[model samples]
Target: MIFIHPTAEVSDKAKIGDGTKIWHHAQIRENAEIGENCNIGKGVYIDFGVKIGNNCKIQNYVSVYHGVVIEDDVFIGPSVTFTNDLYPRAFIWSEEKVSKTLIKKGASIGANSTLICGITIGKFALIGAGSVVTKDVPDYALVYGNPAKITCFVCECGRKLENFEDNKKDNLVKGICKFCKKEIFINKNNFKKWKK
Candidate 1:
């Protein structure tokens, strides 16, 4: 049930899973692995060595650069940009230890967020639109702004859930991850997060 458009250029080395749909003008580069039921929108550029998991949604004009490993059911919003170089240099291979950015399962990134390399965004974490992520984000944490900070805890239901931040007892919430406390919200329609 794959729906790849004719205008799109998919490399032979790329592995596209069943039920995946590559839209108009989208390009999946060599060695890119897209999982089942994923919807790659128009003008999306999936770079080499990038791996996307099942049921993911990548919107228009987004760049999934090399060394990015996106887990299952993640939602990448429109115009989202992922940077692979920490301190980019034209003359040298000075990535400055630019490690890979790992997005765990069920995370939802808002439109136009910029993810800096070497940062591991926690599972089920919600990154707000237009954020510049610099460091590691915890799971189930709702973050925003230039150097993305935790503002609230988001439920898997797309509601702003209660935060046990002030609680003296350290206990795990049901359906949420241990680090971020993000609930396991699988996308209903096609793996994209719905704005509540």
Candidate 2:
């Protein structure tokens, strides 16, 4: 069952999957696709053509504009802003000027983060609070700060992979997570979680 608040403006043309809940004053524009079990928070605006995958938790006041795609299991913290236009002009309106931004599966963005357009946030990556992301984040990376630099590698469980540097040999690094006891293999920019 889908529940939309009385004050929310959800277009009939929008595709809302089952079990989705749209909170107060949320506006889901035409052609926007929201997958199942999503929580569209208060005052959140999902622009036309935006695609959101299943189980996404979009916190209060988040702005998901056109040209943005969020994959499944993503958590967008409160007040997060996704900008589609690289340059602003009050009189200008052009779909060609909007840049694409992708938030891959299982990623989490902390509160008040700003994602500049035209960047891909990789799968299972963690963005700390108040980050200003401007580049493509690698998978399982923990990135934060004004420019969102990758500070360390993290597990899918959101625990830091301690001493990852010590396991590097050739192009692959293998380590056992202390918290979850799961084995992980990192091959350059790609990482995989395996059972022990």
Candidate 3:
């Protein structure tokens, strides 16, 4: 049930799951694995051996380069950039030199954000627009800065749970999401989804 646009170039070796739609002018490379119910937007380029999990939305003009792994239920906003090389040189073509990036499940990457390689963006994290992520983001973190600092903790539905700026050290705050009614617990070191 995969729908590939007529102008799209999908390799025969790529594994596209059911209910996925690849839009116009998109290119899916060999050995790429895309899971079910995903949207690959126009002019998007999925590099060889890149893995994308189920229920994902990758918007227009996104460059999912090699060594990037996207987990299920992720939202990648328009024009997001993923870089693979730590020190890129035009003359050097080394596959082993490229660093890996992992976007965990239920995470949302805002538009025009740049994710540097060798970082694992944790589950349910929200990355704000135009951010340049240089390090690993914790789960349920609301991060937005030039280097992407954790400003707050948020629920899975994108509601801010607690402010880290107001309370910096060793304390716990419990919050209930207004939209989804999910309970969240935030401490100095972790953000947890609590069920009671």
Model 3 lDDT at residue 14: 99
- Relative to the true structure, candidate 1 reaches a TM of 0.82
Model 2: lDDT equals: 0.90
lDDT of 1 by residue, 95-149 (tens): 3545699999989999999999888877778999999999887776788999887
lDDT of 2 at 140: 77
Error (Å) of candidate 2 at residue 146 is: 0.5
- Judged by whole-model lDDT over C-alpha atoms, candidate 1 comes out at 0.82
**Candidate models: Cα lDDT each:** 0.82, 0.90, 0.90
User: Which residue runs of candidate 1 sit more than 4 Å off their true CA positions?
Assistant: 94-98, 163-196
TM-score per candidate, chains pooled: 0.82, 0.91, 0.89
Q: Which candidate's lDDT is highest?
A: 2
**Clash pairs, model 2 backbone:** none
**By TM-score, is 2 or 3 better?**
2
Residue 159: error of model 3 in Å? 1.0
